[model samples]
Target chain A: MSHKIGFEGYKHENNVGFFGKENSKDGKDGKEGKDDICPVATQVHHLIELY
Target chain B: MILVLGQCSDQVIGAFMHHCVKHSVDFAFVDLNQLGKSIDMDELYWFFPGQSPVSHSDITGVYNRFLDWPKQNKYQMDRLLSLFDWLDHRYENVINRPKDTMSNLSKPYQLDIASQFFSWSIPKTNIIMNTQIKIKSPFICKSISSERSIVNQVYRQEEKAFYEPALLQAYIPGLNIRVHACDDVIVAVGIQSDAVDYRYSRFENDIFMYHLPGQVEKDILALNRTLGLRFSGVDLIYHNKKYYFLEANPSPGYAYFESQLSRPYISEALVSSLSRSIH
Candidate 1:
């Protein structure tokens, strides 16, 4: 399953809930969790338009 | 360091930030709503909840996707504007600088600019004020402001009321093509829809990655360069073996296409481009 977040449900006060997926599991430091390294990142085309 | 300025709910900015995190790249995001509260500007401080404060000098390149200023008290807004102005002068690799982005707010102005390019053409357009005006039928009406989408069939009536003149253009029936360009990198998609405005029927529309003719690609690049935009989403129509330019969007919303269509968009390209510029 591909995990995705949408603009409709995002809240500024709770950005960690959106970006801090790793921290959510372990209750680790948000900053450190944010910097967790994943060498193989998804790379796609530079443009994406629906219509 | 890369800085993203926009709404926290903005999925496009969120995705780009994710890419940066996965690659272990230095980046920071400032929600416009947190301007005077969480993000203070005595000298530049970023107070991400639970994270240590960061300074502005740490940032090098900024990906500015801030569409509108926050509706805060006048003093706070002025302070935020001053901070933005300072950043504008400090950073050299800011994508879609404020001035360049502001120029594209008007749809008519952008269409006029796109018309000047050789690879694109525009539909016969006019600002209709009176019902007495005569024009071909099946024309589409659009709002001059980008805030609204008023694409509707032209109906003949007496005493039409418009606070501002509405745009009327000869409706060209053809494939809708959207081209997104970031510097030399460009991606074009063809949209097939039954509705006049494909955006209204997004789920029903069919999307396919398009390969643009070399000349068309060059022309788009030229248009981007001419407008001094590092990234832009351009709308066009393919009719009668010709392309009709629509408008240029300085801050395009690509999250829908990225998630639904599974296309690698500005996410990876933006990181690499910003990283390259910094190095």
Candidate 2:
């Protein structure tokens, strides 16, 4: 077995309840989370926008 | 009035909206998700979901976090292009103009800019395509572009060769400090983690406020100014009494750091700066 670096292998599993996801206490995908800080709401291609 | 540009799903946009409402700041949310649906725009005015059409002249500042339009139609594509051009050329307080954010698209280019600042030292980096260039023993692989990729340590010789161009740099071991600068406010946070990429670390990492040296903080603000970025999140590694510049995230997903802090320092600074044109 190969060692996973960072979130390499665990990304899929950890996506459900990552560090920022904890804000979504109501479990509505951050709809009612504290201050509405939902991690999932961010775009996948966050920084870059391909022209 | 502040013009907020982003999709309805974006949390940073949500957080900014919350701040505006809480502070009694007048603003309009232009959800890009509704670009062609509920929203319509002529050359001079914008029609939001539920409000009177607003003239471009009325907007004093813009908080633009548009990653991409939700749909890709003829109208959407043209509007996206026009909007991007406007964001790039607009004189109003744009947190970060699109062209300024283009620096992050190329890590090598960004590193070159960082190298200009005295407080930052860049790791020996090589962007290789088909050719093999050797760096010191302990090196890590990173994405050449702004696209996210987990930083991986190269243990084997085979890993050094890249079929596609990638950034290979001498790994600097130390604390990860993220510096967020909005206009004049700079908030620095340190992350203590064992994983190569602390952002995706499986183990819990300690997040706390970090105070940068006065000169280093000044240099960071200068770098932001040089890049023409009103807002940015700079990544730095402090190792052996030196700080290594990683990269600056123009459209930083700051909600993560703000969640850990007692107050949303970055967001607050950002919102305050965006609303500054009013008072």
Error of 1 at B88 (Å): 3.5
Question: How far is B205's C-alpha from truth in model 1 (Å)?
Answer: 2.3
Provide the lowest-lDDT 10-residue window in model 1 chain B.
B152-161
* Candidate 2 backbone overlaps, count: 0
How much lDDT does each candidate structure score? 0.65, 0.71
Candidate 1's displacement at residue B273, Å, is 2.1
Candidate 2, B1-279: lDDT as tens digits: 788787655556665555555566777776676666666677889776446778888777888887664667888767776777777785467877877887777889889988998887999998888876555477888888877776745543443558798888887889999888888899999999878787656666788999999988899889988888878888899999999999888887776677688876776787677766643
Candidate 1's residue-wise lDDT over B143-256, tens digit each? 765554636455434234444677777788899988878778887888898777766542456878888889999988888888888877778899999999988777766543
Off by over 4 Å in 2: A1-22, A25-51, B132-136, B152-159
User: When superposed on Cα atoms, how far off is each prediction in RMSD?
Assistant: 11.2, 9.6
lDDT of 2: 0.71
Query: Clashes in model 1: which pairs?
Result: A44-B264, A45-B264
